[model samples]
Target: MNEDERVELVRLLPPPARPELSADRHRLLRGHLMSELREQPVRVRRGRPGRVVVPALAGGLALALVLTGGGSASGPDRSQAPQATQAPQAQPSAGSAPLNAAPVAAVRLLNQAADAADRAQDTTPRGDQFVYVKSVQTYPSTDEATGEATKGTPQNREIWRSVDGSRWGLLVMDGQRRPTGQDLKDPHARPDEPAPHPLGGGWLEPTPGNTGPSGYAYAAALPTDPDQLLAKLKADTKGQGPGPDQEAFATIGDILREQLVPSPVRAALYRAAARIPGVTVVDEVTDAVGRQGVAVARLDSGGVVETQWIFDRSSFEFLGERTVAVKDDGSWRKGEVTGQTTILGRAVVDQVGDRP
Candidate 1:
């Protein structure tokens, strides 16, 4: 088949079947594509008419859904196991319209941050439907000596919009680096499968013996709270080289491990944030998650504006979050949420605890 034909054929396969392709198939497709670029003829013979052709591997790795980054602190390892845990439950209340009863200061700041992120979202959408992509995870890496901070590869750049706030349409980019190893635009939420979710599952197999899907068992066995998750850091410290300073480092590490990977996890942050003395909520929104509700938090702290989207309002199924911080030099830098643009661009900023 020619490049165009092969591409079209690949597109014809079912979503579930796409990722099962072998390396040879991806190589074949690339070969055909490159050859066609050189004005080569179709290499494969004409098999009667198009027989609903499905290549051995229909889906190309768009960008290697299961792998990325030059460092080992990121990406999935087959031998690694996953943690299982339930997202926390936020302090409940009526929906946004009644947010007047919320803290006055929190209301003010949340509105500001939420507005900024919403604007950013207005400017960008996930991507067109004809696109292909995979999901990955990212964390902030720092310069050891200077303590200088750097923006890391995002798990993915995505936009999900739902009018009634029930269902979400995924706007995904092919090859966008993310903090989780899953398919961003997965169609189904199958049991025990690794796929992206607004409130995604957590990894339990922290062991080298447990890697990727083999070591991963989904759901809430992984605690999303600050205190409960501390064990992971202690356990991870075993044969690996030394880690950062203990208390702050462990706290930050815990934050990085939990924040924005799932809506529930993020929601836990938001609930904790609401309890802060100075912080205020400017806006509050609730969207349905299956049967549960997700609360969008818009608030302010220090000088930066933060926003959080927490799914499973009654629980801590955090969907995602974005924070935009004003710098001391009169400039601005986005706070890391799920390690990407802190602004998901929503009218109300939500979620909290300032991820490291």
Candidate 2:
């Protein structure tokens, strides 16, 4: 199938719920299968009256569903998942009563971000192009026994991804060049030692994996209707992680940060997030990069850490993500900063390693 048709068809198919597997193993399987699909000859044919269609690859899709833990073709049975809690809306701010209800300030902010996304003039990238993102990442240290905060370094990060998922990508950290490999191999590689952390940072080529129904094509294919989008995300993450709410929130964050989802989809994603239970606003917060913004956060069950997504207060642009210690664990204190990522820039580029 051609790119446009392929994207549309894939979008229509609901993403599979995440399966139980090591993250690395999952990526490997997805990458391999997706590559295989790409190899099949593209066939153009007549459609009924005024439409063109591509036949679904049942086997490939089924395999993807199974491997990704997306459940069956009928979609994930969310009956077993925990239901979302109803959150109180916030009071409206300033003079904008019509759209600034406090109970839903978080939602309103997201809506604004969505509107900004809709109005954004973005380039339609080519298959061989790349999506370049620059960010600053920080990892805070803590004393395991007392949960006390310790010293940490913030690393400058640059990432480039092949727009078509060819697996050609590059990562640069703090001006240091990581070793380039085809997949998630060790960044500190040698001719002899090879395996690296699956989620570790390094130069990468196409590996045998996919991040469920993530990446550009998957994001573009997402439903734009808020309710439908929320349902899709809930279904995609059902029974997958700590809980549906937390996992769903995380999935949305990944889509925002990791993929080049269309503006409409991005807006839908933000709106869908507003529907999840327990997501409340943190009026002001700082990201790892130290820029301040309003935050929407979700606390995990144990209350050890709260994931906060920070955004510009006025513009509603996404600023970064942060993890705050809500309660003292052995390694962290309450209110301690655990990790942060400040997004600096994102843009479409002509080639891998090209700066936006």
Candidate 3:
């Protein structure tokens, strides 16, 4: 493969140090690969950490590598070829199937999420308690020299909100800079360091925006039926964008990502999403925090980006949300990650600025 193809292939591998891999993903990939090998007269061999070797086969040839981005394991040096090995053919049971063979329906995934949410300890916070959340996000930027897409340093943001909105909220954010290596050091270069925002937190008044508890409470009280919930979403999002359906779809993600709704309401939200046209499921996806999960996405006709919400495959717990450019529109490159947010922590605390 050429240099550009190698880079693109590396991007397709799963991250090596994914600590938050859901059980379902593990099972699905394992079963799928095993079933595929069982049907072929090929021998599989393991290489260095994160590298898998599958000999050239008759029907088709496929390779799967789980490794860190831009690492040696991800970018294999193909200057030399390996010896071939013969393996015995075995039969895979009916239960062994690729995730694509029998994918979970969108409605089923939504109900599964609802069940998990129902089991969660989502306590209604007291008026004085602050709803606290911590997240890390990285925005994409273009390299001035190569014009390749790159990510800026991950910024950590902490927010605290009064449950009743009677008092003010607090927000703290920090940014960091990448270090210039010693070999390529420039006169103006400095060590990799954090450039935190001002020591004090930004104060916020209760409002109807996604940053406040009002939106959370509103989502919590939304009707649980899919039809009613979708109607409400459509009605609220009308005139906000070019297409009401796309706006409604975007609004659902906003509400889920920014609010802490009740279990039934959360289920209703997912189910309502399934009713939207163009909704589709991706068997695998990764979050900004290196967590892996399944995702549900829809093409937003009103915008140039596709909004995707990710969840743990087994428990169906929310992991993060992201937006990718559908086509190059000069503002962003095609397939670029325009926005991403990974939730690190969330809880209810008794005082402002208190982290959970």
lDDT of each: 0.33, 0.68, 0.63
Q: What local lDDT score does residue 4 receive in model 2, on the 0 to 100 scale?
A: 86
lDDT of 3 by residue, 1-356 (tens): 89888777666754444243356755665556544543342122444321123333321222232111122343445433232344975756795533322122443455566667767776787766777878887777788998876656678877776676666666776732223233245554334322322445455555533342235567766889988989988887668876877877888877777456777788778777766776655555788878888677777775587788888976788887888887887767887778898888778788775655
Q: Candidate 1's residue-wise lDDT over 15-35, tens digit each? A: 321224456655665555433
Instruction: Name the lDDT value of residue 190 in candidate 3.
Output: 38
Candidate 3: pairs in clash: 16-67
Q: Indicate the residue-level lDDT of 2 in model 1.
A: 92
Give TM-scores for every candidate, taking all chains together and pairing residue i with residue i. 0.24, 0.62, 0.59
Q: What is the C-alpha RMSD of each candidate to the true structure, in Å?
A: 29.5, 21.5, 21.4
- Tens digits of per-residue lDDT for model 2, 61-167: 64555465653345556563443455996765885323212224455456667777777776777777777888888887677998777757899888877777765
lDDT of 1 at 180: 36
Query: How does candidate 2 fare on TM-score?
Result: 0.62
Q: Where does model 3 exceed 4 Å of error?
A: 1-104, 140-152, 175-199, 208-214
